[model samples]
Target: MTLFRQIYSLLFSLFLLVVASLGYVQFTETQSFLTKQMESDLNNASTSLGLMLTPALEAGDTVAAETLVNVIFEGGYYNNIKLIWMVDGKQQEWNNPIKIDDVPQWFINLNLFKTIKKESTITSGWLQLAQLEITAHPGFGYHELWRIMSNTLIVFSLLFLVAIFTARLGLTWILKPLNALSEHAKKIAARQFGPDMPLPSTTELKDLVTAFNSMSAQLKHLFQSLDEEVGSLRKKNLTDPASGLPNRQYVVSRLNGWLSEPSSGALFLAKLDWLEEVHSKYGYQVRDETIRLLAEKLVQQLNEITPSVIARIAAFEFAFLVTDVEHDQISKYLQTLIRTINQEISKAGCKPNENFAIGVAERVGQMKVSDILAQADNALQKALKDNKTFHWFETTEQQIFTREQWRDNLSHAISNKKFKFRWQPIQFCNGDGVTQRELYCQLELGDKLTHAGQFMPYIELLSLGSLLDKCLIETVYEQKLLERNYEPLAINLTHQSLSDSQFHQWLNHFLRNAPQVERMCFEIPEAGVYSDLESCTRLCNIIRDNGAKFGIDHFGRQFGSMSYLQGLRPSYVKLDQSFAYYDEASHNSELCRAIINVAKGLDIQVIVTGIQEKAQLERFNELKTDAYQGFIAPPENIE
Candidate 1:
């Protein structure tokens, strides 16, 4: 039993005992008083009758004595009245038996009443002539005793109920803090930090609440420290201390992984030609400082166009990669990088040598690492010989529409809601079945269906990311995916959408009213997360409060520490396809292992995506991946 019930029962039982005891005591005392009062009345009646019968008995008048007896007996207050006299050595007697019928038989049998009897002598002058006896009936006494008992019982019953109600309120009030503490404990177990509970009035409960709050605070601090440690370890392993950019090893590993597939990306090599001049004129410190500042500028400028990886590959060489880039975009990006470097050098009061020369190469189809490197080197040698600003290795492509035409088509599609959603199940490697589905949204432009990458750049440029996110939510709701099965439908949200306050409010309200908000999961890309972590975390918390899940897609691509995990506590982390490329190099394997270890330590689920081979799946199985998605499950279209 609960403490409240146990205490209540004990209290009620005690109350009943006290009430019964008092009832019995009151009943007996009233019975004794009534008996004594009846005896006194009978005594008075006997004395009066004795005086009346004296003269008659002395005058030998039996008729008068008998008349007096009959008058007392007919009053119905006495159970018996008798007069006895001696005549010529014989005795004459008159007696009356009780026959009163007003009281119940059970009442009389209960002994609530006691019979009272008394006797008095009949005297004439100084002579004792006869005796008179009077006995009192107990009907009046029985009625009084029953009335007192019934009243006492009613009063005690009311008191019992009042006491019980008060006890219930008291117990609830006392245990209120304990309930809040229980909820707090649950939040802590889920790795969520909830506010502390108010202190209770009872001393013991107050102490307990205080202790729990202390423990929660300590635990939060501990977890935060662990996050920082892990982040430091990650940064130390992958980043170059001098430039604060990823190290050469990190870049090469990433490049190898990216090249493993038929992906379209550019590899740009920018060799700083002024490093030697700066070392000779301004010392090594100034050269190192200039390089660091230039690295920062490059990241700030290039990352704005796209999420690209900038790494220091050598003492005077830097390499960067941007995926899915067109030829003109690569040329524009390199030109801007050279201009920015020159500007920074001039601003620093250094003799601005042609700060750098860049060699850009784009991969069209399956190519070897040595082939791409040789092409980039050949382009660099050409730029140096020709004294040109830069050199590019180009490939052929067919363009059907100009920039303006493509923009108009994309704008029209968004305005007309010409988007199709195809949800593909992410099968669990553990065989628990599919609890999540990946949403691939496609935009239809006239007769063509274009994927996200083809149109996202335009959408982002138009500042319609929030609108697109809203449309996706509405479309999913309209599809009624949850009506069939209540597993989570994962939707990808862009950085702009997560940072938009209007979108946050709209999503919060929408989720509150949506029937299957609990089965919804919003995925933010790993690269997108680095720019707006605070807002993203807040958004994540909001989604979680509404019973939805959040996760980071394309994980293990960033070289920064996974410190964000401590705050976001995403339901799962989906490793990038490159992380599954165990055959690439030992560093890639090490990086994947590090991420998995950190994720596992925090109890986060690890899912591998882009599994196109059974061999890769088997390797992942051996490494204990939580789930897998891609050609293994095969994409299925939703009607």
Candidate 2:
């Protein structure tokens, strides 16, 4: 039960008891007064009657005595009375008829009415009669007492109800602030610090709320201090204290957060290329001071042009996180910043004796932090290849780098047993079809197996995409190939893997050694592939050459042209649902039909995705598409 309801019931019960007690007291007092009054009346009547009959009794007149007895028995003012008299030691009495059931029997019994015969000498100026007798009854007192008790009970009932209503209002009003303060304290405990709520009018309760608010505010301040301290500690651990620039760990964390946001902004990747030469020419203090001066110089320039987060990711490698700038200007700004920094360094009498190289790569859509970092790293490497100090990441160069890194890392992770695999069952159509599974790989730490979605982007950002792909491929072949029935482990390949000849050779060698693994299929994201088709074709050919198949995931939505179909032949082509869904019925439906037809002519099986209803299934079946995949398929929820 609720608190208020319990209190209301308790208060109501107490009120009833109090009212009953008061009613009983009032009723008893009124009944006592009425009883005394009735007794006095009886005494007065007996006295008056005794005086009236004294003369008759003394004369010994029977007729007069008989007349007097008749007058006493049928008195007009005493219709509800009873009379009794004794003459010569013989008794006579009369009672008026009373058949009253208006009062209860128990009540009447409690106030029992009984006759008491009393004899006294009637005195007339010191003279005595033969005898005078009277009978007493409490009949009139009982009736009058009943009426008074009934009135008191009614009054008591009304007063009880009034008190109950007042108690309810008063209790709730008193507890209002206490309840609010309780809720606020709970919210503070949960760390939901915002504005305080309105308090009640009661002084004590209001004071409690005030104290609670003050405590919450102080706790909030303490937490803020702890946060700042933690941030400072982290900086001290991974930063060059003199320049206030990030060390290696700081660079890694920034890259991680940057990649966390989906390819929304641009970051500039620059390498110091020659910090040792500068330090060697200058003394320890001058070198330290020089690095600081360079850091300040970069900060000033970056701030002046556009406010950006500049960090020293490595001992000599620094990074600039720029706002979303036009793609072409990214390289131009990299050139400008390096020239400006070098120019500033020369102004301080430091000759251009040390060679510096720079690389620039911007965020790609849905790219992981590690992957973007890798892109910059790749850019830096390409700068070395061209014998130039700076180079932007071109698709062709990034591919070669991706493949080599994939092979190196895949070999490392697998030999060291760092690869782990997870599977998600793929539902086929309308929640009634047999389920198929897609297995993916992740790197395992002690007691932890992180999902690919968490750190795959980082692999590519650090230009380690190929290594991740190799890890996935090796784990699938070693474990899932013979251990599980989930065929065609849907491993994602980095663009870098596609261009590495050595990795492709290793794949072929492995497949040749295990011929049954020949049925393996690889999936490459369509958007990244179509970004540069020539590289896409080369990558596809290499995989097809190894007796393995390839499919374009998230395909047919974009980069769907005659050339894409003509160049690559896969075992199955999963259709992007843009062509197959219901909401596109009016305008985009025909475009979908066109895609299915194109795939059909090319002998590619089309698997339309995102089917939601039975009607869509019937239409796709009519369209003659093979292997429908959607939430409606079997899972009834997953697309």
Candidate 3:
């Protein structure tokens, strides 16, 4: 029971005891007074009757005496009256039986009042004639006692009820501050530090509220400090201070991440050959201003094309990583980008195309980072040698299917449910065992299974991501894949799925009937989360309501703020795989450490991905992550 209820019960019991005691005392006192009053009336009556009967007895008129005694007995105050002659000891007796019909039998059975008898001597001028005896009836005394107690009980009952109501109101008033404090504590536990609780009037409660507020404020300050520290670390290491674009390290890590998968993209390297001339002629300030202006113009032009990464690789060179664009449109986009940069620099009194050159290298399948970089560099050298504005280095390999072919193939596969799943175990840092298995989906085309990295781009391009998610989730549920063990299965969700209300409804219904629903964790990439945060937040809440978990995949892939983690608190975050390639002394390693510390401070588990070797595992283990997943224990085919 709550404190209020406990105190109220004790107070109620005390009130009942007091009321009962008062009632009993009132009943007893009334009974005693009534008993004494009855006895006095009986004694007076016997004396008066004896004196009256004395005259008759002395005159030898026994008949008159009998008549007087009969009259007195019929008065109903006395139960019995007797007159006896002193000479012959002859007795005359009149009796009346007690009959109390007004009072209940149960009250009379208590026998609260006793029968009172009185005796007196009859005399005529100081001479005794005969002795008189009278017995008073106890029925009247019992009736009066019962009436008084009944009234006292009704009065006390009303008072007791009023007292109970008043006590309840008082308790609620006094405990209101405690309820507020409890809610504040719950918010603090959730890592949501809002405001201080209002102090209560009671001194002790006021003190407690003050302490709780102080603790909450301190925690809020600590989390904010940690977030700021992480942000500062990211800015210091990964961002270019001059143009505010990403530094070379950040772009390289992202490119390496893409290269590790069966993904396709193009890398462009742009050089401003006039930067040295400007620095020597117009000074460093003008040269720096030119670079900053060029970066701003490039950002604006690229923003209209697609999501791409722009980085300052060198003082005069810039790199662009563009994905999800068709191979045929690469030349057209690069031409427009080169023209825009030339036009922007011309405004600074520099000639267009006189010193600007760009190189492009197309990515088809899984390729090494060095090969792509070298290819782009060769293209840049050719552009400068041939005095061309830009040059494209296209790879021999191309996409396997056209847009129409991909649509037909993906539609048929989704309809036929031609998908296979593999489970990758995420082991604990302590080498205890598998914590959970990350689910990887593959498309079944012909007799071969195609990896997600090969087909996911097309799925997203066709806006079939939501359908694909539903197909995979339904297949997993129907196949009872979750029943193999208590370990949870983590599935990655797309931005389309998170934003689709229909998908949300379907997932809610499906999970409601799903056995072991709690053993499921749906994850979204950091890019997907930031794309539509409101939708992601709603989806997270729905999944949590169904007793499942939510996670963020590809964490730190985007340079967006980490403040969203405070509100969209996922169960865990899988660091972007690029961090795995950097060594312990590298700036990326320090960046990784900062991200881990920020996440850990909020009680979020951090899992490092792409640990393909023992040395990599040992290096990341020093960072104190919760778990690791990669080729150290490659993904296993689920039977």
Candidate 4:
């Protein structure tokens, strides 16, 4: 019905015509060749049998004649050598029935249906004794032809098997380069570039390898030239964008890895009671600046305690990991110092008589990063909730032992490489309705797994954050991407990692190793984006340059006033636990609506996370959000 049909039909007709012409030539030439071969062999064998029979007949030995026939058949070299006695014009006896073994069934069956008919005269003592004809029996004619067919097949089979085996070996060599080319094409289509596969042994494949390497180098150049967010590290995380306190995450990670050590200490953790009022009256930033002044005062106070660590741990909370304190005089002396620090901060700060609550905690007997801090944290929480001036969680022997055990297990998990990653799905409103899960690193302890939120501080303290991040990205590629074939996975990033030039180089190098960074969605925590805005921006640029897309994790409660994100846009943003669980029933808060609208205006899709119920899904659907992640869709099936 079309040009394609007409062309195809003509080609098919031509192919059939060729096949028929060849088959006819083969058939005509084949029969004569088979007939001559069979006739000559049969005639020679009969003559040989006769010469042997004569000796037996001259001896008048009937048994010898039968024995001679038995030997001829037993030899089996000739396809046929049969003896027959004509009795009253009917075959009375025969010997050496012909059959060719190790031949194909089709040849046997074909020959079994065709034959030749001819006769010869037999002589005894130079006188004709009987007229003998070698005509095949009507039913057995095919068997004669079968013998000829078997011989013909035997010749060709050896050639065919050799050719097939050779072709298979050759194809394996050729396919190597083709396979690598296909992989390169796939990577390009996915908006990622990876290393070329090993070249084949052929010249053609070597050329392909050269071309692919050139392409990959070009891509790498294009990337490094475009990244500008990594402005300068001299003032890294010096100012916390949210509360303008040196950002606890940055300070703590540094302290845990490179600063905190075994020493006599009297660290103080304090909570501010006036932050909410200031924030409520003025704004989050106004409260943040008040917090900033408090942070500066604490830092200045710590200089008096010199070589001590002080950082703002939360919205209105700060901690000082202090050392060089006498153990026995700690109770009375630290309390006096706390009073002095509060006195200075309160006198300079705004809001009349804005009292600051304080807590004191200490470490004893081989102090651990988390255990020591936990004591201060517990004391801080209690004092702040009650707005107390100072309180402490004095360590007991049992607390010390329990803390020791956790340290052992945590160390073992890292040493033995016994952690696993789970994906929290980040949905996109790509309108394609295709949603995929993003893998986040977490430990898979026997019978009990823990996320970063549960134990990352300890890891940060150990200075293993970079190692941990590398392990996660590598494992996801090997286990989930290549081995398990997951479509994509989301990975988290840290400020320390973004600044570590050596580690960043290692990651880009690793990505070039194949199927590693192709589907990776590196997530910068939404809070981090707000807290350490510069670091987050730099991280996005680095990740993009490495051929990865960035997703904002816990993507809300921020981005309200940031203009930087407008220029350095991420591919997706996951709603924070609070925003994801926002109240949705017959109405929407203006703030909630504003968040969606703003993200939408930036062309950034929103993912509603923590959706554990059907009501949440319906609500997300009502809001017309891009995608939803939670128990409503189990992560495993999507992966």
Q: Candidate 4 on 53-138: residue-level lDDT in tens? A: 66555555668777876676555434333344432332324433445455555565555324443445456767543343343322
How do all models score by TM-score?
A: 0.74, 0.42, 0.85, 0.42
Candidate 1 C-alpha lDDT tens digits along 265-351: 688887877776787888989888988898889999987776788988888888888775555676677877777878776866655
- Report how far off residue 552 is in candidate 3 (Å): 2.2
Report lDDT (Cα) of residue 301, candidate 3: 87
Better of 2 and 4 by lDDT: 2
Ranking by lDDT: 3, 1, 2, 4
Query: On lDDT, who's better, 2 or 3?
Result: 3
Give the clashing residue pairs of candidate 1, or none: none
For 257-338, candidate 3 gives per-residue lDDT tens digits of 8887556669999888777778888998888887788788888887677678899989889999987566655666787787
Model 4: worst 10 consecutive residues (lDDT sum): 226-235
Comparing 1 and 3 on lDDT, the stronger one: 3
- lDDT score of model 4? 0.57
If both were scored by TM-score, which would come out higher, candidate 2 or candidate 3?
Answer: 3
Alpha-carbon local distance difference test for all models: 0.75, 0.60, 0.84, 0.57
- The reply for model 3, stretches above 4 Å from the true place, is 37-146, 198-207, 261-263, 274-281, 324-336, 351-354, 385-389, 505-515
